[model samples]
Target chain A: SAVISQKPSRDICQRGTSLTIQCQVDSQVTMMFWYRQQPGQSLTLIATANQGSEATYESGFVIDKFPISRPNLTFSTLTVSNMSPEDSSIYLCSVGRDFTEAFFGQGTRLTVV
Target chain B: QQQVKQSPQSLIVQKGGISIINCAYENTAFDYFPWYQQFPGKGPALLIAIRPDVSEKKEGRFTISFNKSAKQFSLHIMDSQPGDSATYFCAATMGDAGNMLTFGGGTRLMVKP
Candidate 1:
């Protein structure tokens, strides 16, 4: 298992503003993923970040809306661009470690006012 | 189309009881099914996982029962505890999908003391 951490555990931002959530893992990993959880709903994969490559976004999500950066194996960042009231949700970072098991961060709770 | 679907949006169970959450997938190509448990204010942690080659896998009180023919899987928590109260999610992915997960709507489980 990997120890994952995310900065700004909770943030309040205006609807027109954007927020960048940072994810740091204690060890190097091959794949880092970003997801969003709408209240009372399942987590949706926003993008998958690979070191030195552009992110792979899922359907209904795009890089312009959710840009991702993976500078290295242990660090990644996800920016929710042009936030809206509907963008208020919990953002989480996760990665697979040892075999196919996956683990996640504490998550960043964003409230767009 | 929703790749995965989960039933019982919410459930309440008593301590020492059994908790069952079910999920179904539409893609036969999906080979991995994983269940996660998330506490409030925290990201989801891997609870149990099963591959298509296996019908059932258990870890302590958590078990994953998978049926490849039906493309269905379920999570069973035995001797449920109050600490088990949280949101549970079932996700699937194909190796060729670049590891992007297709998640079902989560089920909220509340275990009473």
Candidate 2:
């Protein structure tokens, strides 16, 4: 199992500010993903961070809002740009090697005020 | 479009009893099904998983029952304890999809002592 470490476990940001959450994995992985969990809601996929390539955003999500960066197999970052009250949610990073269970980071709880 | 659907938004189970959560998916392309457990202020952890070819998979007190024909799966927790109280989510993914997962609306389980 891979061990993932996410920074900024919790944060409070102004409505117009942007925050970048980092994720570091103890081991190399083939795929990395980012998800959002709103209060009392299910986890939603934000994007697939491909190393050396642009992230693939899911429907209803775009790069302008959630920019993701995967510099290597062991690290990735997600930036919530132009935040708003609706942007408050828990951001999570996940890493996987193959067709197996993926490991998740502790998650970053962002509260936009 | 919500590809995955879950039932029983919340449930309460007595200690030593059984806790069950159900999920269904519309996409047959999903070949991997996994359940996750999450406590407040933390990331979700993979609990148990099963493939489409398997009818059931059990690990200790956790079990996953999969019905490929019905496109449904369920998680069962035996000998439930107070510590078992947490939010559970069911997710599905396709191997070729770069491990992108589709998650169901999580179920909050509260095991009373």
Candidate 3:
């Protein structure tokens, strides 16, 4: 199990504004991922953040909309650029450990007004 | 293209009773199955997981039943309690544990006391 700390537990922002969520882990991990959970919907993979490389985003999600930065093994940031009502969702950071277990942070809840 | 499908969008179970959530996937290459429990205002936590090598795996009062041939898996919560009330999501992934995970629609379980 891993302990993750996510910043800005929640926030309500005006539409068209941007918000950046931060994630910090207790230990260095090989893989870190970003996920989005919309209201009353399932979790969707947004991108995979690997240190020293570009983030690989899933289809339907582009880097221009959601930019990710993995500066180190234990820290990562996700910025929701040009936010809109449709981007209101819970953003989570997950860390993979030992090739078997994946642990998640508390998540950042973003609400666009 | 929803690769995973979950049933009973919501569930209600009495205390000490059992709660079951089912999920079916379309991908045959998926080998890792995991169950996540998310409380309001929090990230989804890893509850239990099972690989295709085994048919069932149990951790504490939570169990995961997998059927590789059917491309399906289910989560069973025994002795359900009010504390267990939350949203449950069943996810599948190929390759490593924290790779791009495909999540189900999610089941809101209310364990009534």
Candidate 4:
């Protein structure tokens, strides 16, 4: 089992601001992913954070909007570049270890006002 | 098009009853199927999973039935309790290329006592 942690459980941010969420894993992991969950909806994959390489983003999501960085195997960061009411949602970071199961962080809840 | 599809946007079950959530996938390339459970304001946690080679897997009170031929799978929570109320997501992944996951729409289940 892998234990994951996310910083700033929640925050109320104003529009046009940016919020950077951090993901930390207890053990070294190969893959880390960022996800966004809109209100009353399922999770949407934002990007795959690969250590020492550019994050692989999903369609409709761009690096300029949600930049992700994974400098090491145990840590990653996701930045919501510009905040908006529509961007108010829960951001989650997940880790896949040995291709067994995904372990997720507690999530950072951002409420863009 | 959505790669994974889940049914019963919401469900209500009585205590000691059965809670069932179903999912289907359109991608034949996906080799791993997993179910995740999320409480309000919390990130999703892996609940159970199955591979294409397995038809059924049971862990405690939760069972995953996989139908590889139909590209369908379902989660069954036996002896449902109020503590089981939460949002459930069924996801599939290629288990390669960093093991990125494609999530289904999700199901909200409420087990009443």
Candidate 5:
């Protein structure tokens, strides 16, 4: 199991602004993922962040909207760009070690007003 | 299309009773199945997992039953307790896919005392 720490547990952002969430892992990992969980809904994978490479994004999400930075094996960041009401959701960071199971951070709750 | 389907968007179980949640996947390439538990204001945590080679995996009070031919799996919680009340999600990922998980619609379980 990995210990993940995410910042800004809850925040209120104005529309058209951007919020960047950070994820730090206690142990080095090869794969870090960003996810969005809408209220009362399932989680949707936003992108896969690998150290020293461009993040691979899923359909319906793009780098322009959710720019990701994985500077090293233990740290990553996800920025919600040009926020809107629909962008309000809980953003999660997860790390996969050995492809067996993934460990998750506490999550960041963003409310775009 | 939703790659994974889950039943019973919400569930209510009496304390000490059994709680069951079912999930089915359409992608045959998915070889890993994991169950996640999330509480309010927290990210989803991996509860239990199973592989295609295994029929069942049990950890403490939680068990995962896998039917490879049916492309289905289920999670069973025995002796439900109020502390177990939370949102549960079923997810699948293909081996070597960087562990990018495709998640099912979540089930909110409430265990009453």
Candidate 6:
């Protein structure tokens, strides 16, 4: 299993502002994923980030709202742009090393005010 | 459409009892099924997983039962303890290059002593 570290454990952002969450893996990996978990709800895949390529966003999510950056194999970032109350949720960074199993970071809890 | 659906949004089990969570998937292409556990203020962690080729998989006290014809899978936790209390999520993926996942609505399990 890979050890993932995500920053800002939590943050309170004002409406119209943006918050960028960072993810760092202990070892090199091929793919990293971003997810959003609303309170008392299931997790929704936001995007798939591959090294040296543009992140692929899932349906109902767009890059403009949740832009991702994968600078290398072990690091990635997800920025929630133009925050709103509806956008408040827990953002998680996940890495799948063996393709079958995934490891996750502690996640960043964002609250829009 | 929600590709994966989980039942019993919340569950309460006594210590040393059995805890069961069920999930079903609508996408036939999904070949991989995984169960994740998440505590408050933490990201979801992969607890166990199974492939459609198998009927069941077990690790410690956690077990995953898969039924291909019904497109359903379930997680069973035996000898429940308070430390096992957490939110459980069932997820499915196609086992392809992207390995994009679709998650079911979570089940919050509370094991009382």
Q: Per-residue lDDT of A4-88 in model 6, one digit per residue for the tens?
A: 9999999999999999999999999999999998888888989999999899888899999999999999999999999999999
**What is the lDDT for B57 in model 4?**
97
- By DockQ, is 1 or 6 better? 6
Question: Candidate 4: fnat, from 0 to 1?
Answer: 0.61
The whole-model lDDT of each prediction reads 0.89, 0.91, 0.89, 0.90, 0.93, 0.92
| lDDT of each residue in B1-113, candidate 6, tens digit only | 24899988999999999999999999888888999999998888889999999999999999999999999999999999999999999998876744467889999999999
A1-113 in candidate 1: lDDT tens per residue?
Answer: 79999998999999888899999999999899899998877888888899999998878999998999999999999999999999999999998765367788999999999
Ranking by lDDT: 5, 6, 2, 4, 1, 3
**Top DockQ model:** 5
Model-by-model DockQ, in order: 0.59, 0.71, 0.64, 0.66, 0.73, 0.67
Candidate 5, after superposition: displacement of residue B98 in Å? 2.6
Stretch of 10 with least lDDT, candidate 4 chain A:
A96-105
Model 3 C-alpha lDDT per residue in residues A10-100, reported as the tens digit of each score = 9999998889999999999888999998888988888989999999998899999999999999999999999999988999999887665
Question: Cα deviation of B94 in candidate 3 (Å)?
Answer: 1.4
Residue pairs with clashing backbones, model 5: none
Q: Which residue runs of candidate 4 sit more than 4 Å off their true CA positions? A: none
Candidate 3: Cα lDDT at A95: 88
Off by over 4 Å in 2: none
Cα-lDDT of candidate 4 = 0.90
CAPRI tier of model 2: medium
Per-model root-mean-square deviation over C-alphas: 1.5, 1.1, 1.5, 1.2, 1.1, 1.2
Candidates 1 and 5: which is better by DockQ?
Answer: 5
Root-mean-square deviation of candidate 5 = 1.1
- Indicate the TM-score of model 6: 0.96
lDDT of 4 by residue, A1-113 (tens): 88999998999999999999999999998889999988889889899898889999889999999999999999999999888899999999999878768888889989999
Q: Give the distance in Å from residue A16's predicted Cα in candidate 6 to where it truly belongs.
A: 0.8
What stretches of model 5 exceed 4 Å from their correct place? none
Model 3 CA deviation exceeding 4 Å by range: none
